[model samples]
Target: MPMIRLPSVLLLLTLGCAPAASPPTAASPPTAAPVQAPSAAADGLDAEQQAWVDSTLASLTLRQKAGQVVFGWTGGEYVAADSPEMDRLLEMVERDGIGGLVISMGLPHSYAAKLNALQRRAPVPLLVTTDMENGPGMRLAGGYALPSLLPLGGGTSFPPVMALGAIGSDSLAYQVGRVIGREARAVGVHLTFGPVLDVNSNPLNPIINVRSFGENAGEVARLASAMSRGIRSAGLLSAGKHFPGHGDTEADTHIGFAAIRADRARLDSVELVPFRAAVRAGMDGMMVAHISMTGLEGPEAAPASLSPAITRDLLRRDLGFGGLVFTDAMNMGAVIRRYGQREPLLLAMEAGADVLLQPIDPREAVDAVVAAVQAGRVTPERLDGSVRRILAAKARAGLHRRRTTELDSVEAVVGARPHGELAQAVAERSITLVRDEAGQVPLAPGRRVLSITYAQPSDIMAGRAFDRELAAGGWTVASARVDDRTPADEYARLRALADSADVVVASAYVMPREHSGTVGARGGFPALVQSLATAGRPVVAVSFGSPYLVEAFPAVPAYLLAWGGAEVSQRAAARALAGEAAIGGRLPVSLPPRHPLGTGLTRPVRTAPGHP
Candidate 1:
């Protein structure tokens, strides 16, 4: 099988030698032995690569240089060669001379074909990127076949990063990254915005909940650094995100301004720990958040993406991160609502972001930067510095050598069996039994189970996998689905239905939504759970999205934390419920009051026949 060969710097990164931000805890995995030749150069490139970057910077005109920092977006859907969409994209490349393209979602083969088409027309090779925080399947839709197993489809979508934190294995974290990287690169994605470095210190954080590795700073650092190495090893650039941290904040940046209110000393100890480790690990890039840094500046300061104090002084100077720095999507409400259109673009450049990601208007963004440079608001030197880094990243991704992806090999590489198996394993390992006061878990195989799923009306995929897995495990499952829109009168009837079952299993799918700032068990779902708890049947409450959902129905006798709403997590939760898989995950974050960090109950897998 052919593979994308990485450079020497990437090979060193694969050896897993990033220094520890702090000493390892008993629960934390030991850090790898430090390698001496860290790839801490302005760009982790060879002499030949550096020459290409230098020459590319020298050749570009001011407009092109300004456009080089402006990254545009596109859905991975098929675009005809001569269509208006393709024409607009080509103009964005030729006229605007945009440096990168962010692929949001699409089918596997079509996604690669679109990129190949664009790459062929691009004046300079475009740095194709995506938010494959979990895996490419998170965006791209479609399935692929594997021998004897259900056809593993789309890209291999793993459980969220919190799953890794629960499993607490750096090696597993690396494997997850490697799988995500390979599948992303297979689809022509050069960079993955991943290994969410946010520490997830605040459980109520609506945006960054399960996306974070865990709350502990040192553990988060160790696991994230390991994963970043795996990403680089697969020849895809990895970008640690929401720096210095978005986990400690309450507001969702996708909606409005969110602030990290930590002091500098606390920031160093918690929020910045993983980022520092990312820097030492030679991570290819860092994505600044649309978050305010109250620690560095006063009560009222611009977001870190536009704050020179946070981006240039803190991340670049103090942490010494020389790689590409990307602003969180410029179209996000935090940026658009605060600074409107043009000002944020100019401010982000002044703040030293190499790439203004997914701007609302690419032409306007380029024009704004060009005008700023002309008026001396943004210096030519500053513009050139960013352009140089952008070019260096493209070179590092081997785009300078081969711009187009092999469309024929897309399916063979993406959604392959190994990737799917790894994702399932991560999910299985991450099913943490936080509480089992009633000892109702692993409900004997023949028991009558009333499996009710609570999700938003839009989450149609929530409980299908869970209920199917439970039924396949030899249990008789009477399933009911409740969304926020489910009428209040329906719950009394649902409670009556729950009373007849030997065991009632409630699954909560409260995940983060982009524009919606709040997250929890919505509407009458919590009341339904409370009624279920009081019912004679032993109720097992499993959270497949936010671990903090337990706060809503604290009195449920049995509780399991399966992390996210991904199908893998639902299936794992079902397996854990049926004793098919062992429950080994520990809490990466505290459940608060009753459950502190690291609280979990272990259970051995049932080896008896007929259990499957």
Candidate 2:
């Protein structure tokens, strides 16, 4: 793995401005070393790398320099190297000298081949990146799909950094990060838009639900820093994202502008804590969100991604973040709906963003920036600074030496069994027993268990795995699937089936989706589940997605927070219910007066009523 080499002058500038490093806490794992503050000689650029950066910047025209900061996107699926789309994209790369490409989705080898082809024809080495929030499997098929971070925080069958917080293991967080980094690099990804630092302070936040580590700033900061350290240790750049904070907002920026009304003091104590920790952890990049901070940027503030007050004055000046600043997808409705396509590109640059990600039209965006530089609206020096950062990042990734990923190694390295086992171990460790007032859990094996799953109609029945795991334990399990649109009559039939069961296990899987406003159970599904809990039979409510599902169904007698809808999480829930595994995870976020943060009930595994 190649390392990023910083110029001594740049290091000095950052060192002079950066905040003092925070000392590691007593609870911090031994691996949680205090991040060293920047020094002039620390990772200083090698003579050769510096010479290359100088030569590359000196040779590029203003148009080419502008292109160097614009990143293009590839579809989530495979596009043949010879396809028209590929041809058009390649032409832009060659003609316009685009600096980077973000792969939205693809198979491993096919994606690697496309990336190699693009690198071959590019004027400058491209910094290839992707949103590997759930690991490379988030975008690449056939890779291990780690459970979402929310479940990991609450307790999932998959290992998530949030689980590290629950387990209070900084070393485990580092391990998860290292595994993610290794698997990502194996699949040809250079940088991951991950370890989402959002605090998820608002339960109504449309998009950032379980993706966050937890709601507490200190836990989020500690775990996120550990993951970022692991990523850098694996030789991959980590981008701590949605700067200032997007955790407290109600709207999804992908659809429209989301605003955080926090004043500076509240922002410093809550939202900014993780970002400050990220900087101390030596994070490589900071992705600015499309959110508006009305407190800092005024009531009519520009989107944070396009506001100099938020991006430059706040993140750069106030926080002293010297990393590459990337704007979240410029084509998102939040920015495009308000500003013209070309204007946001220039505005983000003027706001001190080093990368303009996912622009609507790469060529036009490049042209707009070039025109601004030429007309003196954006200065040449400003353009050079961004270009320098891009070039330095590419060099650090070893793109300057070897731009192509090894296609043959993808299958052997990605989704390996050891990695999957690690994910499972984490998930099992994070399973939280929220409430068991009637002692209905560790259910006897002979009980007739009715498993009702709530999910979107189009989504895979996420609860089937739970049923299978329960059946394997010698329990009589009947299963039914219900979505938001399921008719009342269908729920009535499910209730009738529940009457025949000794116990009812209601599994709720509600995750965030674009344009969706809430992460709670939709429609009459909550009512149906509540009816089962209130029925004569004992009901064990299992949350497979949101940890806060209890708020909607307070009547549930026994509740277990499994934290995610993944297969591992489902299996863990089943195992916990069958006395096959202990419930050890604590909540990473506060559920208010009912179940506060760090609340979890531990249980020892006992023989089932009918088993030895």
Over 508-527, each residue of candidate 2 has an lDDT whose tens digit, in order, gives 88776666667788777788
Off by over 4 Å in 1: 1-42, 142-152, 609-612
Write down the TM-score of every candidate.
0.91, 0.89
Clashes of each: 3, 8
Among all candidates shown, the one with the greatest TM-score: 1
Highest lDDT against the true fold, candidate: 1
lDDT of 2: 0.75
- With a 3 Å backbone cut-off (N, CA, C), the pairs that clash in candidate 2 are 76-105, 150-210, 151-563, 152-163, 155-430, 156-427, 157-427, 157-569
lDDT of 1 by residue, 1-612 (tens): 001122222110000012122212111111211111224443668887778888888888999898889899887766788899899888898889999988766678878898988888888899988887776677666332222324334776878888888988877888777777777777788888877998988877988898888899999999998888777767778888988898888898877888988889999888989999889888889999989987678789899999999899999999999999999899888888978988999899988999999898999999999999899999999988899889988888887678877776676767777677777888888899999987777887688899888987545567888999999988899999888788878888888887788888999887766767777888788878876787545889999878998888877999998888777888899888889888888999998899888998989888983553
